[model samples]
Target: MFKIRNIGAILLVFFSISLVNAQIKIGDVLPNITLQDTKNNAVKLNSFKGKTVLVDFWASWCGPCRLANRKLVKMHDKYKAKNFEIVGISIDTDKSKWIKAIEKDKIQYVQLIDPKGFDAKSAVTFGVEALPATFLFDATGKLIAINPTESQIITQINKK
Candidate 1:
């Protein structure tokens, strides 16, 4: 009985470690997810496949996410015409709060709500563990960078 218990504990630890390590990385194709926008519109990631996309995982309650939203708005305004888009995927528990933040931030880019916290299908596919996480993809729909700052986004767009 003791040997069985010890084996079970080891299995549990290994399973947890694997779960935490399950993550999307650079060069991985972005998974197509159909999440809802504030308007209840179905916004599919694959819909904007041709353009270089910046996928930002954030939540209204997150202070850093709020700051990142401000920067993302600026970045969107600057490079939108250059075939770049910033897609804000909110991990907010409340849809109303997510919409309010979008209005308050004047975020012009695409926004989606993930009310299931980080366990939402989109976040799971992207393996997002924290707020304000970002993934940048190129025009060909290939991920180029992960967790890039606003300045890094600007530089990447300019390089294209």
Candidate 2:
């Protein structure tokens, strides 16, 4: 009975670790997503490879997203010259509303609209179940952080 119990415990631990390691964790190469920018031009994710990029998934109707955008604006202005870039991906069904929000917030970064809303391919590919979700990628295009805080982003930007 003791041996059987020990085997069961080992299996449980193994499965737990596997589950934790399953998702797109840090250091993973982000998938390339080509989408239309606010100007209706096609933009590829790889275009930002040579710079540190922040890919933010947000929605116009989400209050938290708006708040996060405000913070992002400040961050962008502070680190833009340091090779830091922000790509705002809006999962908004209404193109007009998305454009309006971008103008109202004065977002100076690249803004992309996903007309599929929550079901957007980019959102699904990134497993984004929440608004204001952000992924930070290094100059080499390797994802360095998932859902990082404002300070965390700043720290990464400051790193050599």
Candidate 3:
């Protein structure tokens, strides 16, 4: 009797988890990745240099992410004119559903679609292993916190 095991699959799983765990920390600048807006416009992370930006990694299929969008809408409205912005990078492969979610959620902030789902380049850049993952960055584009609450964003953005 011969026993066979898929070592490649095991290695892949191990390596993927490690990659997700290896994330950029506070004070580290988020890697500049270009994403597409609704109109397919190129939006680069570096373009938001002087604004306090929050990059929210989410998907249309995730309920928590949709729930978080409601709060994010409020935050964006309160801070948009004050040099604060929320860049929502959706990890949804379906553009139509992503747009529907945005419209339904009333997310007025910047909505970018990666269309690669969790395997999107933007997700990899941010090491996003979970939905609703948020990275808060200061005006200088340096990461200040992850999964930051409304209060934290309020405090940090107000400081600038």
Please, what's the RMSD in Å of model 2? 5.4
Residue 94, candidate 1: Cα error in Å is 0.9
After superposing candidate 2, which stretches have Cα over 4 Å from the reference? 1-23
lDDT (10s digit) by residue, model 2, range 49-157: 8888899999889999999889899999999999899999999999999999999999999998778976888887776888989999988889999998878888878
TM-score of each: 0.87, 0.83, 0.85
> After superposing candidate 1, which stretches have Cα over 4 Å from the reference?
2-22
Residue pairs of candidate 3 with colliding backbone atoms: none
Better by TM-score, candidate 2 or 1: 1
Task: Name the top TM-score candidate.
Answer: 1
lDDT of 3 at 21: 63
> Least lDDT summed over 10 consecutive residues: which range in candidate 3?
1-10
| 1-160 per-residue lDDT for model 1 (tens digits) | 9999999999999988887666677888767789899899998887877888999999999999999888788778888998899888988999988988999999999998878997888888788888878999877888889997667777777765
Comparison by lDDT, 2 against 3, better one:
2
Candidate 2 pairs with clashing backbones: none
Scanning candidate 1 in windows of ten residues, the lowest lDDT window is 19-28
lDDT of 2: 0.88
